[model samples]
Target chain A: MCCESDQPSLTQAGHRRGQIQLLAALSAIVLVWCGLLPALGRTTVLRQRIAFLEARGVNPSAKFFTEQEAGWRNAAEVERQLQEHPQAFWALPWRHR
Target chain B: MSQQSRQVSDDSLAMIAAGLMLAVSLCCTALGSTGGGGAAEAAASAWQNPLSALLKLPKSWESNPFAEVSGWLPGVVGSQLLLGAALVVGMLICRVRTGEFLLPFLKVFLLSVLAYVLAEQKVVKYYGLEYALWALLIGLLISNTVGLSGRLRPAVRTELYMKTGLVLLGAEVLFGKLLALGLPGICVSWVVTPVVLIVTFWFGQRVLKIESAALNMVISADMSVCGVSAAIATAAACRAKKEELTAAVGISLAFTVLMMVVMPPLIQLMGLGPVVGGAWVGGTIDSTGAVGAAGAMLGAEAEKVAVTIKMIQNMLIGVVAFGVAVYWVTYVERTEGTRPDISEIWRRFPRFILGFLGASVLISLLYENLSDGAGFVKAVVDGGTKTMRSWCFCLAFVSIGLETDLRTLSRFLRGGKPLVLYVCGQALNLLLSLLMSLLMFEVVFPEAADVLRK
Candidate 1:
């Protein structure tokens, strides 16, 4: 019963097919990633800006982003605001409001 | 292939993975970014972008491709595949009969995607019909209608998926945030949550005399803590049946919907300040998403206070899960005339909890020390973990549905004791949470409340 020859053909076939399916699924995912890596390069740049702003103690809310983009608030001012109201900087919603 | 050896190996793998994550997280903290004292990010209630598909409805499709999709569609899908492969690899490492996991895993994944897509619908998102409930319902529909086939049985790993997710979830339970609002937040969340859970469990056992103590405990934890997540964790800790867990989740989600709708308006009518109002909803509501919604309806201040309070309450699940595991092993499942020793308890105690706590402590400390604060945590740590965790939970819920015979669940509902148990527990929760919130915010720590107001 412990031997490979003892195992039924149907069971062996099923196992083989399942392994192949798993690999195939994984391959498809890899292929998709390969296709989109270039597109993702631009997105990564935006993410880096977000990270830089966050590193400067700026709140990363949409409002903060808009303000920064419009030159209404700079990193220094945002940092000051964070110092005064730490909780306010992190008061974004966990989910959709 | 003895059960004991299998258990040891499985637990060993979990512990190793957990330890590795903690160590890596600590290293990341040492190499932390230079972002000042801005707060670190914790796991949010729902995914910021839940849906990720190439084909979008015409109305959703915008002019720019980047704007239309979330910039990197492949990254999202590839990341998910990586998570799936990781889990499968973990199972295989533990000698979980490799080829058998694929079809069932695929089924669960497909169901979860469907649940996510359904949750993405405008109306569903508004009502907060989360993927947890949808996954369970859809799985239930398939099982009850066509019935789960033999091929699916090999992949139905509800406990495994849940345990993995819980361990990942542990990273998000930042202890530093517990002191964010100071002593008042601690008293309201930590104090009220345990009291309500204890009282509810006692009520179920002594007063209600429910047949399954595990079911009672699961429901109590679910109703008093953070809904589905709590239910899954507690169920695993106490070794509750799949059907019983399902029933508890069903009851929780039903009341969660009602409470989310009713609580905000009631708080408004009572003329509670945003801090008091948010704390009330945060402490009482079972679901984190619903708590956010209820708070949002009140105001921005309320939303902030409520979500923060709920985050505090969320931390209690680890303690509650550990306590339940200890209690069940020592008191509930002890053999007559023989007290289990420390080693016995250690053996019986759920190993995943060690993983869970380890992850929490690691990530919490990492968050505290790290610079770019929430941004780095959100983008790097939580971003990867959240995707994996969501998949694990979705798969777990689906597996639960597949394994559960609706008939068994219906049997539990026959006397409506579970419903009564949930309702009564919720009632106590509401009253106690409200009183605790009022006393802490209004009387004991008015300054903290003022800070919240600011």
Candidate 2:
């Protein structure tokens, strides 16, 4: 089964064509089944969730200060105070506080 | 019209099959493009804050493109002429490559099954079937159908396709974030993998006495380290025969599917915490995508833990590949009288892995130097890499399905030893990981555990 045949017939071509059609149909069904349909469902669900959050006035994307962020802020403040009052910074009541 | 005439007919049939396989591959690519592109556009709309958008779209979409595709198909199918046109073009490509249609055709079917299972189970909130399934299937198809009992010339196209896919896969390996698991994650993976490999190899050889060292190693690496991707990397490095590669992939995929379906509920039943559960699942499960799905089923925390753990494991590919290459050359090649030179090592080394590492390193450097600019670029790059990787994997699956014969696969199952080996190894992985996570994190090292909690 390794050689080419002479003068391909209409029937052979038709057979090949039919196979391609079947495959294409199957692929389309799968594409929709696996990809499109579920995506639609998710979009609906997400939209609902977004709407609900908006209604509740809760920003889904709100940024809350993390401990790391707080630490950075604290560090910057300490540095600023140190730059302002080099030696006697530790003596101040506010600095001690 | 005697023997020559019959030979001619056989050739024609083979040609027809080849043509069909090619057609199906083209169609799959087209369908994937349409489905993928439509999803991308919708995801772009969802990408309001590019950095946040990247996190939302690519992570979610990569985890499950079907969900994304479904969301956009309803509204955009009409307005997005490009999607429809792309779909049509994909169909036409399938038509032209009609002879080799069965492989990709089977893949679309398998992908559908996986997608349905994922959605029905809600394994991951938005993820569909694992992309690794597609890759495994394509690898099997190519090795079996196109590469089987054929002249080198006939198989050239398929091999070219396989190599190209591997190269593209390299682009997906982002080096920087791979280190996020820190030294602990890396240490765990490195320690566990070699132990598993050593045990499995010993069992395969001394205990089971399997004739093929190559087969033993391939299966061991696949089962112990990762799945088909690991098998392929190791197989290439070891210069294993095509049959060995095929057998290892087939075995790995079968177990992976079973594990993906079984592990989630098992974890829930065991009442394992997210960190423990994620570590257990990540260490035991063969496929990364499936691990994510299984983790997602547990909870967001579990998903994060599982994915992070698996990412660390995935990063081990480079180390494992290099080690295997060195071992194979020094040990196996020396005894086998096929010692390869340095150039051969370069040739045999799956080059795309370099791309994966390169992309990862570049991303890391960018993130370090330009933290603000890094996120946006990383997002786009991640999206592109994921798309390409998935496509390459899908194509490989199609190739595998076309090449495989069910009878041959069944013949290998006469003895239940391989199955037993896999189960035992996986159980060991679960127990080991669970113990480590519990003792090291929860009790002994609460400080480290706190890092995960955050």
TM-score of model 1, chain A? 0.32
Scored by lDDT, model 2 comes in at 0.48
DockQ for every prediction shown: 0.03, 0.04
B395 Cα displacement, candidate 2 (Å): 1.7
Q: Best-fitting candidate, measured by TM-score? A: 1
Error of model 1, residue A68, in angstroms = 22
- What CAPRI-style quality would you assign to candidate 2? incorrect
Candidate 1 differs from the real structure by a C-alpha RMSD in angstroms, to one decimal, of 11.3
**Per-model TM-score of chain B:** 0.87, 0.64
What TM-score against the true fold does each predicted structure earn?
0.75, 0.58
Cα deviation of B207, candidate 1, in Å: 0.5
Candidate 2 positional error at B394, Å: 1.8
